[model samples]
Target: MSPLHRLGLATARHPWRTVVAWLFALVALGGLASVGGGEFQDNWNVPDTRAQAGVEELRDHLPDAGGSSAQVVLHDDHRLEAAVVHEVVADLRSTDHVTTVTPRLSEDGDTALLYVRYDVPTTDPAIYEDISGLEHATDAAADAGYEVEYGGELPGTATSLQGRGELIGILVALVLLVIAFGAVLAAGLPIATAVGGLAAGSSGIALLAGIMDVSTSAPTIATMVGLGVGIDYALLILTRHVERLRAGDAPVDAAARATATAGRAVLGAGVTVLVSLMGLRLAGLPTYDAFGFATAIAVVCVMAAALTLVPALCALAGRRLLPRKERRAPEVSRLGAGAPRSSTTGIVETREVKEPLTARWATTVAKRPVAWALLALTILLALGAPALGMRTWPQDGGSDPKDSTTRAAYDLVADEFGPGANGPITLVADLDTVDRAEVKQVHADVAGLPGIAESGPVTYSPDGKLAVWDVEPTTSPIDERTTDLLASLRSDVLPEGVDATGYTPLLSDISDLLGQRLWLVVGFVVVLSVVLLALMFRSVVVPIKAALMNLLSIAAAYGVVTLVFQHGYGASLLGIDHAVPVSSWVPILMFAVLFGLSMDYEVFLLSAVHDDWLDTGDAQGSVVRGLSRTGRVISVAAAIMVAVFLGFASEPAVVVKMLGVGLAAAVALDATVVRMVLVPATMTLLGKWNWYWPFSSVVEVRGAPAPSLETSDDERDDLEEVAR
Candidate 1:
């Protein structure tokens, strides 16, 4: 027997032992996480990049100006007193994390801006707690009839997830499973397996946090992937077991057969996902590496649970897994069949059947392969057109929810001072000499540059070798104009010795680096996917076709994200009130995730087709049979994924919402348009060439005749056995 069959038998025969083992592991990991798990670190430091070099230079040459900074915007309908501003600045200086606080009054005398610097990075979670005292101080100023708002990364960091959306996603997944299975136990088993997987995966991430800098977004991304695949893998195996039980097979035998066949598909699909996620390391970004490791761990835990815990649950429930009506029906007609006939012994006799809708659809596509293929391609191309116009940048306070204090402060500053007041570019100069007249001349030259709103007085380091100038832009931080301004300053405006470094310049550098590396990451994932699929199916054409189709689906998803979020098409529905550029890292991350996930359907369907092709040696017949058999299961699995992903669409963070919506769309399109329509049409057109490789001559005759749909009872039994 295959190892999968043996595993299923072991779990089935000793359900209690398997259950206890899993429970013990889950509890032990949870305890370990609670006691020893370290906090998540959002380390945005990209090494060897301009941003890193700038940061290093500042820390080395000007230690006092090397920390994360925020702006406190105070406004009063009446004239603000200078004494009150000084008091507020003093209170801010006394805050635990604060290193310095400097206040500046607006010319109108009604607005005050206080620049506060912290010893820690903006992405550090500790800054949030430390900012509480500053918030309290601001509250006191507010009581004195001034409006206090925080404008910068500090307020943005305070918007951590409430986790309600994740719960809702699971609930929705449960509902979809119930609809798919029609029985409570059968529906609950996948959810149980998924929940167990999620617990283990989350705990693993927490433990991993202690060893390295893991992004705060890692948990959410990992959970999204883990739950989707966990439920999917279990569902595939459970569906096969049900099919076996509906036949005349014994419960244990059915479980074993199901695990051997469908479970193998699950295993293959899981490996593809793991490979694709781990390929994120090729992006040469640390955050991507952290995300890759965390998500890969989640996928591994969930896949293991699906292979073991799911079968154990199935064994424990036995026939009780189905409803009473289904269990009592001794010889029910096969799925998608018309009706059962009464045998002479009063036992109902049934024949193996195909889903009429999916079968007819497949036949139709097979008849006019070119038309159907072109139609699917056209739809994808149309959906993907918007991607060409996509713009990417790191998320900032300007993109925060309107109700957030950071956003309010950003608007306040933009209104009173200038839009660029929220993000000022800094010039760090290694001066030949620190002469006051020469520094003044340098500041004057910078102030005369285009797009410069105002340039502050040059501040010299204590050692008197480094000089710094704060130059505010005329546009918001994420504005394209601001990016152009930085480019102009770097190439034309700044003197030879001066270097620009600040939030704006760092983000700009990061964005540029991402754009350059995006292709490398894509090429890595594509090449890896092609190689993996080629080896798995042993067919060059099949992998190439699958890769192209997956890219189409992902591109379509990107276009949808751009249209909705960037173009403000459905932003309000997803809780985004303003249009924002896609997050710089989101496209690469989304591509990795979507490629892996779309392959789930690809592997499951193609594996079935390959099995059918080998059995009958008839390419067209295999396509029809495979589609008819796996169509319903794949559709249901896609539905579950879509539900889980879309559930996170209401996430407060725009970046998270972008991921949720993009993933949901990609899965939906892949299952329906790509899998059901494009794949079948293309494979039908390929005929015998679908499985052709350099070694095709050794396998079989090149022109084997296609078989008829009907077959003898023995042949039908063989087909059904293989299908399981």
Candidate 2:
């Protein structure tokens, strides 16, 4: 047994006091709960060299200009009567921080928009206050004896998911968890553990963000993950404990064995998961670095809960946790021919391996490596077939949320006056004491370009030192055609002194950046994961083997995502409204998550190998036996994560949905096919290769081999050895 396992078992000495203390402290943590929102910006890293700069210039010219950009559309219902408009405008402008309201015109004359302007940036408290203003505007219109409705970015995103968002989701999840577990107490325990873990996790995220402005999308992500995974891990330990009590053991012994065994899984899984997330830091994007580090920190808290509070609490509950029927269950059968009496509700005795009824899933591949490899390649190719059909790459700002008003207005304008009307190409040319006529010639050159649809009146800056024009293109903003037009504006039309920039220009720049830098990120991930694995295993070959497994898992996930989201296969069943362009960030995010998740399974399955090899010195046999034994636990864990991801995917927003579905697909594949079948078979084929590397495999076990399925005596001493 690993020293950690022995150490955890030792925690069962006084479980009840630990339980009481945990419950009391958890209750205290609840009262201190406060809601904190994120940086809440659409584009975090865009530079001011393009049309973005021009937009800022326009905002700067306006009086007391607030940096808020929102779309307020009045539907073409009879609600747009003068009284309704008057009431809306009155309420909106009368709001404490609101400065202006600009109404947009519909093609028809009846509908009018009241653009509710704010004097504060999106990150300010006033952004939320404006949502209240929206509510007031709606009420004011009704009070003035007119009907009105309001929907926009501010309400859909800002207000709807603000305070107690995680708490609300937890409450709903609690109801589900209680029903699934068949005990209120059982369900409550996981929630308590998760809340404690999240409190610590969020603070960790704040620390990371302070170091570098990590992607603002991280908090929501951390909350969802920390809660879900923390709760699930706690449930796994609790379930094992209940099973132990059902058998014939006392509370302390039952808790001891439960912590010794399941604790191994939870701690190993958590560490693996944490390491995998760190893979994103390899990608070099500051955005992903925040995501990786935040997830890792949260996962660490989860590991702490697993190893400390949970085991202690289980010990405290004693026989009360396990009913009389469950108390009769035990680990092994006396006859060695029949199952034990522990048909406990949570624990069922079952055969580890089902005889091959049709195909030996792992063995078949193990016996015929080339044939299985070819078959795997063929399946990957078939799934990737839909990549050919993924059109609609990106429009307007690539970062534009599908429901953004500017993009929505651009879409409507495109449908009517042509896509060109939506995005106007910007011409930025420097001015000096020289040649005013040269600037005019530059404007004329761009104006006469074939794809120019609508040209704005030439406007110079306040000092007459700069000139600019808004040139509508023949395509929607950021489309391939517009990109081509942008190229023309820069290369063919611009005079020697003129510069052209727009949404397309920024997209172009980012594309170049991604192309130049993405491989460096990939290399970092590979090197880091390998080095970490070698350090953990004391076998260089182990890291190489792990990298291959992680790649396969990631590729399979990409294939699944491509097939589902890109090809529109079973998308409706998946609740996806549109098979839109997957975000450019998806690949980076997937590598980070997949690598981290693969580490989780690796730690889990490899821990068994580590233990068995120590006990039996049969590497291949150890893999088979360890895989057979750990299969159910990892599968159950993976299933829960998949369900969590799928549930989140049901949201309306495409990006958020993409994240969920992508992780769901990845986990689903990882559990069944990758972990169960491919991993065992491939490792079986490459016997010694699984442990080959530049460094020698430790002939003697290291002092500590991470938290895995087994324990070491020396490692136990380091963990505060106690006589239980």
Candidate 3:
């Protein structure tokens, strides 16, 4: 058989391939899950500060941080009397991990706070299990005639990570997949694959973290990306394969042909996505490097599953998969061509694409590039306008709302007490020495800083050599006023002290660090994409255009995301209840993931156009027809991604929300607007000029195509018809 027929037969035998792949993945998944952290978080969200200088500093100064920590809170105040606190503290000290505990007077004096410190490190693997025993410790309080009420970080962090993160995410993810894929089983399969695939990937990350800077966020990202791309891509291929089968071929033949064509598309798209994500390595931030590596791992595994495992499963469970197909027929267009369309509710059955932009849409867009391009550019810019005004930096969620307060507290304090009440500005001073007078001078200077509404006393490092202070700025963390004040201190204030002594300054060095890395990160993102695309297209111009397109997409999506999340505009309607920061890590991550996904579409759509141009030499016809043929699946894949990723927008955390929303928007726009129109139209304007530089030698290309473009209209027609 020819390569075409061979691919068809392989797809028809997809069941076996799937079984083999699953068997392979399952072993890795099992090993991965065996060592999951019960409740440790990497705390990447929390930037390192002079830990001894902040609340810890205050607590240290207060004479005791060793307070009795509470695990569960009770609404009844009378139950948490002094008797209850004393008894709980007494009982907790008996536990091995509980080094000491002290009871405290609550803000009201009617209620009280208990501070607890562990003899063991919080990073210990058994911390959750040990901390979970707190309820029993509280039970001891009840015996002493007090209803023990409790609350703190140990409970919240442990419970959120161990109990809620995956459970809630899994449930939500499944519902999202069903909604996105329009088939329950179809959606479920990808989720299952991801569980296994991501599990293995997370294990690698954790293992890597043991030596590198990989943190708890790495796993969250690993899992999320694994599930998002894995399911999204698998569902795309599956849906396409089923559609091809419904178009007339047998299950076997359909699987094979779809495997060859759509599989190739899926594989090529996966490669592009992987390439895009891998580009983040260029950013030079070790965290981003780890993220880039982990993300690349997931993309690779997801592609493997989508092509090999999914295909094999199709072969094995060819007909039984429609477990609900009999009932679903009326509502879904299954793989069986003769199947009848049913109700409109289930699976969102439809012959046409969802919310149809209208079939006439293409013709209209084709007719008026200037109008649509202007309109799109206008909308994107308008969406991004809020971003130009955006401000953000790293923040630590650890102290915000503290340990005792639940979700009930953040807004209450931030609103009535001012946003500054939530987080304090930490000042780490590497003075010439820890001389009492020098320390006192820096203290007075920082305290006098404009935004310093309040300041706690400074504390010396272990050797009494370095002092650190905590300042509660009147301004919010991300406010221009605060950053301005910080800059002023760094530029004007720090130099005076530093000049007094020949010692290097913290602010000075850090400033230089950020300045150097900024351009490096930008250059990394741009250069890698250019190199990858150039190699793929063998045209420097193509790579440049692809990079430009990706930049436009990222900028546009970020603009809209900032508008929705940061400006609190339409957030409520989207189920976002309050304003939020655009995750600081989002820019680079979007660069990697979106760049990959956008380029995925780029390869899928453009390759066909390029193939046409190569074979028959009609760039215009090839562009139009290529887009037309690939348009449907590209739209479907993008739509599926939109649903999966946008589902994550419901997450309260900005990072998860950003990843989902940013990615969804980028994929959707790139497919519909960029790939379909801008690319085609731009190429149209360029005509044969697109292929010209093949003769020039500005950029590198080795053994690249020396396409003989000379051809007739008849030849172009034949190639175009065949390619379709």
Candidate 4:
């Protein structure tokens, strides 16, 4: 027996022991995570970049310039009083995390802005608490008829929607599973296994957090992937178990066989996901690296649960796994009143007696291979067309929910001072000599630039060797206009002695860096996936076809994201108020995730086909047999994933929403158009060449028979029965 069969038997033999052990591990890990898990760091550390160099210089030379800053905007219909403004500024300066506070009164005096600098990055929990308290301190201005709003990283960090996205996803998945399996017990087993896997995975992320700088978004992303794939992996295994039970195998023997077959597929799919996620590390961004590791941990945990816990549950449930209604006798019609009536019912008779529509569709596609293949390719290509115009930028306060304080503050700042006031570019200069005249001239030249809204007075370091000036732009932080301004300043406008180091410029630099490195990362994942698929399937053409199809699916997903989020095609439907650039890290992360997920269907369908081909040496027969066998389960699994992913579409965070919508669309297209139509059609056209290799002659010379389309009708009938 294979090791997977051995594992299933071992788990089945001692179900309670396995259950108890998993429960104990979950509890212990949960407790440890609660106590020792470190905070997530939003560290966008891009080494050997100009931004890093500038930041390091400031941190080393100027104490007050090292940390992040927040903005407090006060608005009133009437002219604001100087006294009240002073009082608010004094209160802000008194806050524990506030290092310095600078107040600016609008020309009309109806608005006031206070810039408060912090001693640490805004993602620090302590800094967030301090900012919250500062907001309360500023409440007195609001009480006095002045509208108070908080902006910048503080409010943005504090207002993340943290409720029930995962829970809702799981509930939706459960409903889909119930509908697919038609058995509450059968459906619940996958969910149970998923929950256990998620518990362990989440705890593992927490432990990793304690040791490294994981991103704040890692847990949410990990949860989304872990739950969807966990349930999917278990569902596949359980479906096979049900098939074996219906075939009249004993419960333990059925579980072992199912595990040996479906469990191997699960392992391959999980490893594909892991490899894709780990490819994020090649992007050379800390956030992506952390995301990769955290997600990989979750996948590993879920894959293990599918292998061990799912089989244990299957063994414990036995024939009772199927719903009672499904297991009961079916009503058969009598051909004639005079004829002797016989009531004959078995598991398959009571269940779906006719072949599924998917089987018929596969047969039709196989008959017209070229046309179906072209149609599938056309659909995917059309969907992916919009990706050509995709843009990337960091999400800012403008993308925050309108009700959030950050959004309010952003609007007030834009309405009063300027949109650029919310995101200013600071110039830090290391001078050979303290020449006030030269610094003043440099500031004037910067202010005269095309996109400049205004410029702050230059402030020099105590030793007078360094100077800093805040240059406000005429657009929002995430606007392409602002990026253009940053580019001109860095490349054309700024003097040789000066360097830009501010939130807007830093974000632009990060976006550019990610965009530049994106291709390398994509190439790595594609090549890695290709090599892995080639080795597993032992065919170059199959791996190449799979990789290309996966890319097509991912591109379609990107195009959807571009249309909805970038072009505002369906922005309102998804609750987005306006079009925004795709988040810089989103496409890279999405590619890794979607490629791996798309492979899940490919692996499932092709592995079954390969097994059939090894037995019968007929490629076309194997493709039909494989599709007819795995199509329903693949459809059900894909539906579960789509439901789970789209469940998070309502997330207030635009990034999360993008991920949700993109993943859902990708999975839907991949499972149906690509898997059902394109794959079988392509294999039909290739015939025995589908499995050809340069080394085939050597194997053939060693007395191995060549693969041939010599399968008998009896063998086809048996395969069809097995599929059913």
**TM-score result, candidate 1:** 0.93
lDDT of 2 by residue, 1-724 (tens): 6665565566777665655665565455433333332343333344434544544544454323325444344444443466666767777777776777766454654455565555655445456424656666667455654424344334434423333445455666577666555556655666777777777676666655545565556776776567657876776677667665544455666666766766776776676567657666655355666777777878887667766677776676565454334335543323223553311122334566254321344555567755665565455455545544433332233223445443454444455456665455566666753266887776776778788877776766676656766677877654667767787676776765566654445555545454445566667767777776677666666768678767766766666777776666777774554454555567666666667667777776776666655444444555665665456556656766666676666654455666777777777776766676667766677664565444533343333232222435454344222210
- Once superposed on the true structure, which residue ranges of model 2 sit more than 4 Å away at CA? 1-10, 20-43, 47-68, 74-125, 128-192, 203-216, 235-272, 275-290, 317-377, 384-425, 432-436, 495-517, 573-577, 697-724
Model 2, position 295, has a per-residue lDDT of 78
lDDT of 4 by residue, 1-724 (tens): 8999999999887888889989999999999999998777777667767777777777777767877788888999999988888888888888876789989888899998888888766666677524566777687797789988888867677666565677787788788878887788898999999989988999999999999999888988998898889999999999998886765666787788889989989999998999899889888788898999999999999999999999899999977787677466331222122433211101233333576587788899999999999999999999999999999998898887777778898888888888999898889887874366777888889989889988888888787778888889999898888888888888987777788887887788888888888888889988999889888877878888899999999999999999999999988887778888998878989998988998888999998888767655556877887888889999989998998888778888888999999999999999999999999999999976777666544212111243433545676455444433
Q: How far off is residue 561 in model 4, in Å?
A: 0.2
Score residue 189 of candidate 4 by CA lDDT: 95
lDDT of 3 by residue, 237-291 (tens): 5655565444544567655655565566666667666666665665544566667
For 410-489, candidate 1 gives per-residue lDDT tens digits of 88888889999989988887777345566677789879877889989788878777888799998998899999988887
Q: Superposing every Cα of model 4 onto the true structure, what RMSD results? A: 4.6
Task: TM-score each candidate.
Answer: 0.93, 0.76, 0.73, 0.93
Ranking by lDDT: 1, 4, 2, 3
